[model samples]
Target: MAKRELTPEEKARNGRNIALALGLIAFVVIVFITTIVRLGGNVVQRTF
Candidate 1:
């Protein structure tokens, strides 16, 4: 079996898609971290 090769345009599109996916993942991680911090602060306040 032979592997398929991508044209220049297709490669460019793939690069763009990868960047977009990474950006979205970063945004989600930031939101999750923020939620955890807020939850932790609330727990600390209650303990004191």
Candidate 2:
């Protein structure tokens, strides 16, 4: 089967989707790092 090319709208949508995904991933990573830093090395010794 022959491959088809993407329309301009499809390209734009793909770009936007990629940007949103990257932004979300970055946000999650930042939050995770912040949580780890806030917890620190003593996290293991702390009682729940």
Candidate 3:
């Protein structure tokens, strides 16, 4: 099957969608790392 060329508007929309997806993924990863770091110190309890 032959692929058709994307118009300027379609190309722009596709680029915006890709950027949004990547930005969302990055935000999630940052939040996850922050949570892990913040909670990591208290995870292990010391016995007296």
Clashes per candidate, residues 3 or more apart or on different chains: 0, 0, 0
Best by TM-score: 2
Model 1 RMSD to the real structure?
2.9
User: What tens digits encode model 2's per-residue C-alpha lDDT throughout 1-48?
Assistant: 998999999999999999999999999999999999999987998888
Candidate 2 has an lDDT of 0.96
Q: How would you encode candidate 1's per-residue C-alpha lDDT over 1-48 as one tens digit per residue? A: 898899999999999999999999999999999999879868667854
Can you write out model 3's per-residue Cα lDDT over 1-48, one digit (the tens) per residue? 899999999999999999999999999999999998998867676455
Model 1: lDDT of residue 40:
84
Q: For candidate 2, which ten residues in a row score worst on lDDT?
A: 39-48
Candidate 2: regions farther than 4 A off: none
Cα distance off (Å), candidate 1, residue 28: 0.4
Q: Candidate 1, clashing residue pairs?
A: none
In candidate 3, stretches whose alpha carbon ends up further than 4 angstroms from where it belongs are: 46-48
TM-score per model over all chains = 0.78, 0.87, 0.84
RMSD of 2: 1.3
